[model samples]
Target: MRNENQGTPRRTNRFWVKVAGVGLIAGLIGGGIAIGIGGAIQHHEAVVSTRVPSGSNRAGGTKVNKNKADLNGEATRAYNSVQGAVVSVINKQNVQQDNGILGMFGPTQGDNSSSSSSNGKLETASEGSGVIYKKSGNAAYIVTNNHVVKGSSALQVIMSNGRKVDAQLVGTDAATDLAVLKINSANVTTVAGFGNSNSITAGQDVLAIGSPMGSEYANTVTKGIVSAKNRTLKAGTDGTLTSVIQTDAAINSGNSGGPLINMAGQVIGINSMKLSSDNQGSSIEGMGFAIPSNEVTRVINQIVKHGRVIRPRLGILYTDLANISAKQRQSVLKLPKNVNQGSVIMDVKPGSAAQKAGLKKYDVITKMAGQQIHGLAQLRDILYAHKIGQRISITYYQGGHVHQTTVKLVP
Candidate 1:
């Protein structure tokens, strides 16, 4: 079950064929309604309602620095900005997994409709969250997580001002944990603003605004500093994500698709998931992660324009040459045959970008587009930053001679 980030030598690229499919399967696994957002977004009945600490209820106000800026104002502004567009997930027709250890494999939406409107499975609907991207032009696209819309085909979105309407799933990219939905509405209000994720520095204050625990507190805010930037977690695509921002703002089960904001009240990240292991609500201390806005923007534009994202491919299989002496392999990586370390390209897929650029099997690629390709780590990054038509230069070693070539990528 290991993925690309594991550093294990892959025998073939068969793993990718299974990894790339966009999949969603809904089942009967109900959860409590998440509630507690404020006047900005209005949700239906299925929201979780937990009271906040005495001075913290400024509409999902987090624990960010009070001195950094008028943070309370920033939170309120963020709240007001997306409140009307957030919605409660309606999971009445879906079946949630029974309360057991393997429950996560079942469906996830719970009773979101009025509590009194009970259907079978002792649930009505599950509560979730969303954001409206475009307004008053063509159709309003409300963005949420793919998992949220999984179990049920029918969906309902609630605005911050307290209105509910039907929403349709536009498209979802599971690799990045994001989804877009289209809703036909007249003058639908409030679209969230995008901010530069790369500009987020260490110690910069930020907030998480979403329906954690369900829609009760629609714009609930929690504050924290940008813990780190460009962190490569061994979670997906082999450090394939760049400029990924890390924060400790409290994220909960239903917080997916919510916004993480900067002092200027602009979105810098999306609150995707938190590491958790139990039903007692326990999580790793001081640990929370987000999908940087850069990745979000790229995926959104691709989905809106082409119905799916087109990630460029290098089409090569790799393995570490640990068994071979560094002295012998140095020339293999374009480094001196006497140099100390590098990975070996064991095989090249026919018709691949690598093969088309004169990269032959057993040729050790040392650099890509002038950036050092130490292992699968750096190699994945160089190819990821470009699109299908972009060109790049490659440096490799063969026959004790260093050589270079250029490659044009393909989707």
Candidate 2:
């Protein structure tokens, strides 16, 4: 019952997948309600809210009776309150694909060089959703999933009012799958505020607002209840997301980076990825997950100020011994009969904290900073709790013997 990160090699079919798109068209247009934004943008300052005129209807002239809608009462209210802050994020990138053995065996009859398999250059675009979380002077800040803007040659932010503006990548943190983008504040309207993610409970009504699919469905709203809380998911080969919020609010591919709002009209989470199916290949529904807003704020603040989030690194590359076969463990690493799990260090960087502490290849880290470690995830979690240049104790096993040493962390 081990969880795996999206696109991990070990769990090829059982892995998670990021919510993004491929082969997307360019210059897609959309229609949605407009909310006007005014005044100067300021850091950490709440954006001014302007109420829609009474009797005003959506672009299609459909009137929504806020009080009598069949939808969840609190969800409807939350959606209407925060919809104006949801945005569409567009990414453009150059994609190149090379034809392999098949190309060498066929399709060489064409005499023209322009239509050959060698030229695999293509134009690719993708769309995801984002939220306007802050404004400072002429700039506004957007928080989105890192996968949304990962390989962008250019980025654009489409406001809830249908106005599209160029956005600059402020900073990105891959370990957390979050990114911050900045754009001109002129068209910025409603900025969503954060709620206490720690207070969210299962079965509470929630709303998801985003462009689910593309601008064609911009600001689409879905309603559901919080399915679960503090669900752990793999982040990468060596990292795990310890506290993601789970919801059943129909989070699709384009919904990545969008806001998950609570009844109080505050953002509780950022939709990131969804579980599609079991290893047996059955369809899985109502299993979407999001990054808690509290964690989002912590990473966003660091990214906004530093252009990157800095964390202490132990400067070692290793594989989880748990993933290795028992035969290999017994034959190669030569651990004691009772030893079952640990992180086997493969390489320690020269002059690194591990190297300075006399850690070497094949040394299995069994504990760190007083916490027992089973694999990389636990070790990473424990190591990251300490700040840069802080000293911590490490316990490891080498040549069937246990040893402990104190090492100072570095960026």
Candidate 3:
């Protein structure tokens, strides 16, 4: 019985060994098939896909192109804000026409055909720029240079949207070179905002918007920086000193009365004029001036309220004492040796404040209103500060003797 049991165990062990060998062969085949399939899939992917560096651009990528957003910067913001408020001012005058009647030698005066249509007046046109600063009820106020509307038989304002409307001259102040006009506010889209010129400093960014050469270039924008905070520029050969804000922005002939825009999208200045050439006939560039918004607000308000700027007038035609030769000073007017800079009274109008105060021709005004007067500009600066009918003291030199008198200012 023991011998039979031992033989049965040997038989069982032999059967299990054969089963293990068959299982090992089948497992190896299955593993090889799985590895081959993975390699084929990976090879297919490598062949079909395109590879690129990490930072490289793709055909359809998610990056922003800043150049395409050129109109999204501060300059664009400022221009966009005020461009709509700017308009072209046209000055139409009835000039005499030149018909050359009876040939060129007929009459010295040209025939009035060109200027005169049927009623014998031909229309001549001049242009500048202006800003719509205020809108009240059915009327909108536009501010421009006084010289622009000077001698205009008719005035027209061309809006940004190409609408032309008649403009009535509200008031004009030649001393400040500012004029106010009114137009129907029917299609007014935007009214420009004002900024405190006192808050802006030199070297700040600025933009000029205007009809540079006419309505053809209306709303043309030029960029620059504030070259100076305050510049005293003479206007109209009168040597009338006007305090202005100097900028490097390009201001052309037709740019006068347009707005000088700041980065905050506010009008800080009014483009007044630019230096065209020096006395030596040298071309000048990058020198442009504007009326400061603070002064503009002050002057325009008075112009709007009154038909003119009611300045306290002493009514004396004077020249700067510095312009007089030292010989003339010591010989004609006989001013004191110590007195050099002041306004020399040339002609005081009859019944004027100066004349009423006993001032006469050749009287050198040394001081006014307790302030030292160096020249006509300084005297005007001080004189305009007082109201009409106010009593002010004046000091003068007559025949090398100093005298004092009180004068009542008048408009």
Candidate 4:
């Protein structure tokens, strides 16, 4: 011991250590260490590693700007995730075909004559983006849009490292504009997780990854912001309002069914449609929408179980009841129990849940599940809360007497 308890030497050593720690932190704040930190943190990639991947930077190198780091991270996550989920998709699309009946007119619809190099046997192939939700028995069930792989059932997935595999159709739901697919392949790479759409705030950064007019470029990335939320747009193909996650991300024709990812690489929505002048009135730009992931999970669960998402209809027309003759009553004006309140049962669908439950014309619903019936929106919200097969208790005013009934839901 060289003065083991000496205060002078101990103080000097402690001062140097603090200085070093501060220096390291400062370097990470705005120096090249940030890229390294990002790589490490993502890898936890937060701890330590002997090997650094191609896209990752080294530790204590530099710091990236807040915005830049966020953008870079989002793009990287999307590209990696997209590539991983794309497995074997390219293999299905890029095969050379023969000169057909119209010779130079190209292969006719539903032609699969180019998958083999040795013999003239027909093997099927098609190009589309597939999202991995879960690993089913001997296969992975991926989801995509119907139109992408509609005609031919043959599905292909391309992996991050360029490996390919053939996929199958799981199920489809046309009403909700969603489809589920499955594929069997070894070494399958990624499964995109669902992000909470309800937690999304406006102005948050977002990224869209898709092929878009070029199926070969399967993992192309575009940047944007959460322009709005809970936006109700239309998908003309299905007469229902597409409850969507509106963003400034550029979504083109072929981008449908791709994911809208956040900086953390979590998918918040499914890229569904882009608002074009043809879809709207005037020139619409920077407006794109995605199906909320919450809705996606629900529809997927239904399709996987029942081959369709069963939505029970509560038979009644809102217009049947008269509201207080105020224009705003439909929106802002509150409803009273005996006045502009619940929908009057006008005409019930034959053998519908309402009809079976003894609901009749002019019957006024006063409350639902003990919640006051403000109007149709409130009623719709309450009803939507119940799944098909769930029983509901509703109170209504009819025959000058208050009565309640339990109704079983059906899709």
Q: Which candidate number has the best TM-score?
A: 3
RMSD of 2: 31.5
Q: Mind giving the per-residue lDDT tens digits that candidate 1 earns over 167-280?
A: 776677766667777887675866777887877898988888778887677767788888887665543322233335678888887777777778777778776666665578
Q: Residue-wise lDDT of candidate 2 within 1-411, one digit each (tens)?
A: 666564477555433332122212211211111111222343214533454446844567656666764766666778888888899999977564433334657534334333323243434489999999998999999999999998898888899999989999999988888999999998877889999898999999888889898878999988898999877687422365456889999999899999999988999999998899999999999999988888799889989989998889888988888876778676777778788878999888998889999999888888889888765656776776678889999888887788999998889
**Model 3, 1-411: lDDT tens per residue?**
366576888899999999998889889998999999999999988977866535744576677656765667988878888889999999988865544455556634444335334444636478999999999999999999998898888899999999989999998888888899999999898999999998989999999999998889988999999999877678533457867899999999899999998998899998888998999999999999998898788889999998888888888999889999999999999987888989998998998988989999999998998999866667877787688889999999988899999999889
TM-score order, best first, reads: 3, 2, 1, 4
Q: List ranges where model 1 is wrong by over 4 Å.
A: 1-75, 82-127, 136-138, 234-243, 277-283, 319-346, 360-364, 373-378, 398-401
Candidate 2 Cα outliers beyond 4 Å, as residue runs: 1-72, 93-124, 196-205, 226-243, 324-342, 398-402
Pick by lDDT: 1 or 4, better one: 4
Clashes of each: 46, 4, 7, 26
Please give the RMSD to the true structure for each candidate, in Å: 33.1, 31.5, 13.4, 21.4
What TM value does model 1 have? 0.65
Clash number for candidate 1: 46
Clashing pairs in 3: 97-114, 97-115, 115-121, 115-122, 116-120, 116-121, 116-122
Candidate 2 vs candidate 3: the TM-score winner is 3
Measured against the true structure, the TM-scores of the candidates, in listed sequence, are: 0.65, 0.67, 0.71, 0.63
